[model samples]
Target chain A: MAELLVYLAATLVGVAFLLALYRFFKGPSSADRVVAFDVLTIVSVTAIALVALAEGRGIYLDVALIYALLSFLGVIVVARYLERGL
Target chain B: MDIVGGLLLVGGAAFLLFGGLGLVRMPDVFNRIQAGTKATTLGTLLGLAGIACLQPDWALKLFLIGLFILFTNPISSQVLARAAHRSGARKSALTAVDRLEEDHGA
Candidate 1:
């Protein structure tokens, strides 16, 4: 059951990633692309968590943490740049 | 416990899928921000919770990730929205309010 669920979740997340990628490419404005990128990163973090579970490794969780932090900072920086020409 | 965790994981993934759909289907930048931010935040948190359940010993780290996400996601989204608005991202004709515009006196 766990195995089946893991595969199901992975498939769903993969589809979500594709959708975000589409928006990232097709977005009419930079802000829309940024929003799509944000969603992409969040979905990636969830995928990382799923990977950790599938592999039974605790170390991947730490990687997920750092990825989340960096992505948050990246988004903030980009947003600031957009707002104030920084 | 495994079944419960798996269920949660699937549920979270489902939410993420919807968020992605909304990101693609929303008519404008602000609406995309709303859909992407809110749904992904909840989905990520729930995914972390599911992982925590699956690995009881790693609950602490999972909780930390979840907490960080809860705080930062909204802040980032708000900043993005403000930036978008300030940079003149076009709004859909369906939008009926302009409170931020009024506040900015622009």
Candidate 2:
């Protein structure tokens, strides 16, 4: 049952990634694209967690942690640049 | 335990799906930011919790990740919203107010 749910969760996350990608491509402005990018990174983190669960490995969790940190920093830097605050 | 963990995983993924939907469907930058930030934050946290439940030994690391996301997601979103406003990202035509503009004098 847990294995089945892992697959289901992966499918959902994949759909979420595609939706975010559409927004990234079609967004009317830079801010909208940034928002889409932010969502994409978050979804990816969830995907990584799901992968770790499926693989039954603790190491993948470290990758999720680092990815989340870097993504947050990247978004912040881009936002600051947009506002000319950087 | 497996059933409970699976349910949480599915629930979290569903929230993420909604967040993505909101990102695409929202009419303007601020609305998209609102949807993307709040929903993803919750979804990521819940998904991490589900993982922790599924793998007991990894619980500490998962909790750390969740805590980090909870702290960073809102801060990043707030910065993005302020930047969008300052950079003159167009607001939706149906937007009823301009509180940020009034307050920031931008």
Candidate 3:
């Protein structure tokens, strides 16, 4: 059952990644692409968590945390540049 | 608790799917972000909680991940909205009400 859940999560997140890629490439504006990219980062973190669950490992949680922080900072930095015209 | 956790997971995934659908079908950028953020945040949290249900040892870390996501998703959305505003992406004409920009100009 756990294995099933893990695989399901992986598949879902993988599809999410694909959708995000479409947005990244087809975004009408820079903000659109950045937002899509941020979401892709989130989806990737979730995908890693699912992988950890499948493997029954605990270390991936830490990786998720770090990814969250890095994506947060990246999105903020990019938004700042776009907003302030810097 | 197992059943409840499973339910939460299902519900979360439903909302997540709805958000993604909204992203694809929404008329404009701001609407897409609004739809995407709320749904995905809740969806991901519930899904993570479901996984935590299976692994009691990882529950704390799961909560931490969820907390970080809750904090960041809205913050990032705000940043995106700011960028959109600066770039002059108009809200959908159907929105009918928005106070932030009104306050901004006042």
Candidate 4:
């Protein structure tokens, strides 16, 4: 049952990734792309967590945390540059 | 327990899908960020919680991951919105006011 749930969640997140990719490439403004990228990273972290659950591993949780931190930094840096504040 | 965890996982994924939809369909950068941030934050948290339920021993790390996400997601979105506004990203026609502009002028 849990395995089935994992597969379902994976499918949903995969669809979300595709939609986010479209926005990332097609957004009119750089900010829109950045927002799409941010959504993508969040979805990725969720995927990583799901993987951890399915594999019964704890290290992947650490990977998710690091990914979250890195993405946050990336967005902040890009945002600062956009505002000419960096 | 498995059933509840599964429900949470599915619900999170659904929210994530809506967030992506909002990103693609929202009228302006700010609206897109708002929708994406709120929905994805909740979705990621739900996913993490579900993972915690599936693995009782790893709950502490999962909790920390969720906490970090909850704290950072809004801050990043706020930065993005501020940057977009300052960089002159176009606003939707339906936008009512420009508080930032007024503040800058004052």
For every model shown, the clashing-pair count is: 0, 0, 0, 0
Best by TM-score: 1
lDDT of 3 by residue, B1-106 (tens): 6555555555555556666666666777888888778877887898788778877799999999999999999999998887887667756689787686777741
Model 2, residue A76: what's the lDDT? 93
DockQ of each: 0.90, 0.89, 0.47, 0.87
Candidate 4 backbone overlaps, count:
0
Q: Per-residue lDDT of B35-93 in model 2, one digit per residue for the tens? A: 89888989888888787778889889999999999999999999999999999999889
Query: Which runs in model 2 stand beyond 4 Å of their true positions?
Result: none
- Candidate 4 lDDT, tens digit per residue, B1-106? 8878887888899899999989888999999999899999999989878777777788888889899999999999999998999889999999999888888841
Candidate 3 contains a number of clashing pairs equal to 0
Model 1 iRMS: 0.7
Candidate 4 error regions (>4 Å)? none
Tell me the interface RMSD of model 2, in angstroms: 0.7
RMSD for all candidates, in order, please: 1.0, 1.1, 2.5, 1.5
Candidate with best lDDT = 1
What stretches of model 1 exceed 4 Å from their correct place?
Answer: none
lDDT, each prediction:
0.91, 0.89, 0.76, 0.90
**Residue B28, candidate 4: alpha-carbon lDDT:** 94
Error of 4 at A77 (Å): 0.6
In model 1, state the lDDT of residue B13: 92
Could you give me the TM-score of model 3 versus the true structure? Answer: 0.86
